[model samples]
Target: MKTAGRQTDAIVLGAGIVGVSIALHLQERGRRVLLVDRGEPGAETSHGNAGLIERASVVPYAFPRGLSTLAAFASNRSIAVRYRPATLLRMAPWLARYWWNSAPGRLDRLGQAILPLIERCLDEHRQWTKAAGTESLMRDEGWIELYRSRRGLQQAVKAAAELAAYRLAYDVLDEAALQAREPGLLAGIVAGAVHWRDPATVSDPGAVTRAYAALFTARGGELRHADAAGLQQDSTGWRLSAGGEDWRAPEAVVALGPWSNDLCEPLGYRFPLGFKRGYHMHYAAAADTAPRHPLCDVEAGFVLTPMARGIRLTTGIELAARDAPSDSWQLDQAERQPLAVPEGFSLRWLHRDGAAPGSASLLTDALATLDWPAGEGSLYLWAACEHAAFRQIRAAARQYLRPEIDA
Candidate 1:
């Protein structure tokens, strides 16, 4: 491979959803861009996720009653948002800031900051996918946060208030309504529900990713199949070398997902992205017990997404790196469904991605530098849903830092 002598306007590292999205946005803004990734597009966490573009997720990251989760561990399945106990213990100090951010105020601010971009981004996703002709593979169906216990229902009430503050739409469903919505649901299982109509999920997340790449190319943006090794700043701009080629870009965006921190570390700036490795079990379906809407088990800590390909039961997050080996126990635990799956459902014997415990780990040190707290509370929110703390932090940043000028 030889270097493309023309200066690159921007070089984006990583081809995950976020990275690719940034590339497309930059290209649309008329900047020449190059996207680099080690793996095929969408092969990482973004490829295997629940494929949800959740707008109601605007509620801050922390739970309001987080303290209770620490005491009633078993009763608070949802609070165990991040697992990988073995890895977590070793990275405890690094994980502290996340715990602090889970404080009600911090999550609120985080939610507010992100809300503006989410719905618009989702709309863009839909438009871009449709233009690429992947409409059928994408489902506009909503996400259901189900509650079987009274405590669960109370949690929904708090979530409802938070959703309203964000102006997100939701409807509460009783047992009868839920059963009517999904006839296969086990009897006596539903206490209530909060339905988020804004979230759109895709049947095949991979297909969506490929479609984005295709659409980008169709729009005349070049796709380079190469590994981005490093970056060098020069008087003109930034020079990026990869695949035996040296490229220059006036502006650069690093959306490398889990690898973002590592790629930027040498450059003296570390991104605050913790690799919360999630697990998923795809089952060969036995019965036609398909869920039209995605199911979020508040107590089970996983989601049962029935796609055209197969039924995927995914849950649990171990804070590790992109290469970490799958924690067999975590994947095994996914088989234990909190509720009954239609007969014949079973977890895939192996994790689709090669991630396991200790396979790879996130740069947790970055979290501390970012001022995130360490502890369970940092990982889970127990305060009222309002993310007040995060807002104050952002406000303080704006109070000090000057606004960024347009490139």
Candidate 2:
């Protein structure tokens, strides 16, 4: 490999939001930094998510415990969860660990551990958005989770109490109140709604990521197209090939997200990393009608959020190998009843709006608003939870770079 014969303070692998954010922070601290990625920033998993910078997500997703819920998932009757048998077999050990970690006490501890970082999401993202000049992409309208039955509503309310303990604000809206706030919603369809008022949404998740990367470059940091898999260590520190030249850095960070294991495994570091694949499709709303805010169809197991392109419908998790072929069965089932759209909203509208029917947008817009006194959507499934671990990564990097600085 051709060597550039240059050294920097640090090199960050991956160009997703996590990597970009870390690079930006390091550069802000006066570290000479180089960010390497195989493709354009945020073009992978970071691009395709319900775009909520969830400040209220104090809890991580726990594995299902109820027999009925487990049965629905196993029988493939649930739209919210799907799994390939072979993938499940391969993931059994990781799944077992996840299950054990999801025990009430363990999950609660995890929540407490990550709560500080979740609380900082808004402020941290605000700083980046401001510097990146993407402030207009953000919205403070929060989200809503609608329950179809009294039991579901009650359970949600009980859960809200736990969330409230963390100072996350929410409002409970009964059916009439819910309809009043979101007239486009089918009247009387939902028993109640929980409006989370603390979080913010983004109009275009990918654009925000790109904007942050732009800030990184403008701040004198480098964004080089390179495969992180070629990273190597040397007596001086670390080196990697990118853009046909080899570069060196005293330190390196692996923020590859789902592919983080590729480099870590070869380096003999093993972490029980897992992923839940999801899908999303956008559609045009009928004339003069659109969801005011993001809404989670709790029973249906999907989300509908108003977006700049159109209305985005995001599906729930699918347990599969990282490289498994894409599956649209969940999307097909979710299309049966597209919530947050008018009665006549259909595939025709999507075709008329320039997006072909069933064409998926690799990136999704965050949340919308409602006409009611208060309305919001579910916080689950958005990409913000990953920030929890990102905080730890940042802390470790800071400590390593500034050994003279006190914690």
Candidate 3:
């Protein structure tokens, strides 16, 4: 391989779904793009999601605002979300900011701001799914949100009604209706469900992501596997090396998902990004044994989706470091849940060692596109991510390597 090269039009770090999609979009625009990652595309965070392009999720995920809910989580015994005691102190400010921004008016505004993106998520995925010829892996029927209590179901129905202006199609299902729709759901513990009819799902999200990456390559975009730690910027552009060959690009986007902060911190773009980790394991079951659509147990805070491997269950957030060693406590509880199935490695087993790459949940929905060399970022983004953390990260950033940030 050549030891050096002329600059490409763009370099996208992290080959997960987000990175791959960005690279494909850039390539579609006729830019010479290099998609880089240390491992195969979609083999990380992209692989472990609940396999839904949730079009019904018009409202963004907000911090829990209820006193009981907040108190319940504070004890850290909740199955849905657990946090490391050590992370609490360090994350207090971010948490406070999150709570503040979750206020009724603020959250509503944020929801409206991201309405366009949420509305178009399926259309965007369809474009790639079509281009990648992975249509066989997709299911257009969407998923179900289950509630164990009438109160829970009613709340969800009320929320769905509020979102009527968004024009999302969903049905409030009583026990009879839910059982009728998902005969195999083992709904004895469920009082009702919300059948969201818009969001499409996939059997294997990782495979779909890899297919998109493959499409990117087939369309003549360069893909490289290399450590992004070696990334450096100079007058020419941003540079990285792979196979002993130095690669340069006039522009680059860090779409590393949860791992984005790891590389961006070095580049002096560190914000107090939340590393919310979770776990997933496949259960032994066939399509007949599983529901027709992915089912989310709202009370339990997990999603059960039918996959090629079996029924894949994903747990909720565990607030911990990105590189924290895997914990068996959550997995143990997860297995004991209603959806647990008995199985083994070949065809009838469960893998106890599975963990998901944490999502870098940032307060700033995104940093406005940074300029090259000057590399100044904007904290002016409103609605979606307007909060105290913006000012906090901005103040903290100025004390670092002088990244010429714009206030």
Candidate 4:
């Protein structure tokens, strides 16, 4: 084990999914790395996210027809990308560009880039979990995108087309087919469904992160508890300042998720990274009435992943400023969004105080807990439309550092 006093070859700023994954991958290549965070691992945006490995989130949320689609979701509050008036105003330019970039061909390219990354990440997750003796936390039972209206279902035909062209396995189901599979849809609520069999779900994201930290330590990587405040250039490398401690490393990687903006601004790496606050409350399902697999409300911006003891209803995408408490209304919307249930079924919210109104549970007590990150935490690796953008940066950085490291 490396003591914190020891200098290392690489220093990772931020303990979020991206940072930790990078550290673990570097360790695999026999590099000595140090991961620093303000608190523990898996404690920030990573702690509270929709736990789906979105092999199908190929289309960016703000694509063509996105504004109108968002308007449609405004009334229901159950769909995938709800728009807050204020945040939308601030994000207008980005939204416009995002929509313009959603040309069919553009969407195809985006999906192609992201799907492979997700596939790779999921595979890596499987290996990491298995090595840490925690493979059971991930579920391979497939994901369902349920449509309540024919037009809505039709809107997703493009997504279906993409899925098929990409050779991803899925099944389009009518109301009958959906009900037969899950027996939870309210009568007439679902017009059709698209089931993607390959995507995986994490039962407990925090537990998984803990397991990964253990694995990383066992691989001879170092973990340090310190608030990553800033970075400065050194003669031969980078100087990282955190928790009043200074350390130098030949290379440094910033995988700080939402906080990337704060940590990178002083270094002239001005990136427009924003936070989309998401909410999920666990609901204790009636033992006899629990849904068997995870379900995505196609129109709803969230997903419901059922666990052995309860169901976790995670939804909403409030574009709040980072570090702000989640908007109560949005979380309520997720809780209140109706789930089609089987006859004679009953469900109740688990963490009522933590929820706004009608929220759903994320998982049973046996699964895990959503403990808040105190001061700092670990990373929860996720992929988004920005994967290509970040990869380009990584590639460029590698080229620049090859001479230094190899020399």
Those runs of model 2 whose alpha carbons end farther than 4 Å from true positions after fitting are 1-4, 338-340, 349-407
- Candidate 3 lDDT over 1-407, as tens digits, reads 54567568877787876667667776766789888899998887677777777677766677888899989888887778888888878778878877777777877776665555565666677777888999989899878999988899989899889877777888888888988888775646888989989878889888987998899999998998999788887766678886567888767766665565667767776654566777778777655566678988888777778887777777788888768787756656766676522233114546534553334345433222233333432111111121111112212212222232332
Native RMSD of candidate 2 (Å): 9.1
**Model 4, runs deviating above 4 Å:** 1-5, 58-62, 73-79, 241-245, 342-347, 352-407
Candidate 3: list runs displaced more than 4 Å: 1-4, 339-348, 354-360, 364-407
C-alpha TM-scores of all predictions? 0.80, 0.86, 0.86, 0.80
Q: How many residue pairs clash (N, CA or C atoms closer than 3 angstroms) in each of the candidate models, in the order given? A: 44, 9, 4, 31
| Candidate 4: residue 116 Cα off by (Å) | 3.3
Specify the highest-lDDT model's number.
2
- Better-scoring candidate (lDDT), 3 or 4: 3
Looking at candidate 2, what is the lDDT of residue 20?
Answer: 80
- Tens-digit lDDT string for candidate 2 (77-131): 5679888898889878877776777788877776665555566777777777788
> How accurate locally, in lDDT, is each candidate?
0.57, 0.69, 0.68, 0.58
Q: How does candidate 2 fare on TM-score? A: 0.86
lDDT tens digits by residue: candidate 4, 47-121: 554456655554444343656755675664544555567776886665565555566676556545444444455
